[model samples]
Target: MEFYKLKANPKRLFLLDGSGALVSAFFLGLVLPSFGPLCGMPKNVLYLLSVIACIFALYSFACYFFLRRNRKPFLRGIALANLSYCFLTIALLCRYSQSLTIFGWTYFGLELFIIGILIRFELKYASVR
Candidate 1:
């Protein structure tokens, strides 16, 4: 649970999060544009979502490199940022869905699970001193 241990083993969590972020970004950036049209969201809203996704992707990439450096602040920042995104995603899903589909529920569950794991990892590995 030492900082060094967390720093050393951070790859698993980092890759998990970074990959998720990248995938989310890609969906929002590329796939969502088409999906949005089908989903009935306006072009303006779709563009806004795409912009947001691009920003999230950039942030995720930054966190990936920062975590690679093993800097405590960057680790903390990444956790916070991802947590925020998870919450926002959940809220969006709930707001948008008329009735939750299996896919929606599964995605929400996975996001929450990952957030919980990241929280535990952060606490366990955070510098005590």
Candidate 2:
């Protein structure tokens, strides 16, 4: 884990997280809705997820710009938020498993995997001095 680089400049983490969250919001809120039938996830649920992503993005961006120090709490906050999102997604997946298409499963699975990786980095760096 190249936490040394992150420790040197934790601001970069906020940027990366914010950017990823924006992408998630865009896809979930705008792009995915058009493919609802193929994805087999409701539009409302996707929009809700997108809204959450937007909130995450806002928090990350705010931290990046405004936080001069004491970032551990914010980092943990995002990590926890990401964990909560993963759990919510898992629950949704289970609830909609019967209706969710292969594409939906694949998409959500990839999202979970990616976020899980990010969460690991966030948590690890948050623990460092």
Local distance difference test, each candidate: 0.58, 0.92
Each candidate structure's TM-score, on Cα atoms with residue i matched to residue i, is: 0.59, 0.95
Give a tens-digit lDDT track for model 1, residues 17-82: 566666655655566466543543344544555565466556655665655555556556667766
CA error at residue 13 for candidate 1, angstroms: 5.1
Candidate number achieving the greatest TM-score relative to the actual structure: 2
Question: What's the true lDDT of residue 88 in model 2?
Answer: 98
lDDT of 1 at 98: 66
lDDT of 2 at 74: 96
Highest lDDT: give the candidate number: 2
Cα miss at 76, model 2 (Å)? 0.6
- Inter-residue clash pairs, candidate 1: none
lDDT of 1 at 112: 69
lDDT of model 1, residue 72: 56
Off by over 4 Å in 2: none
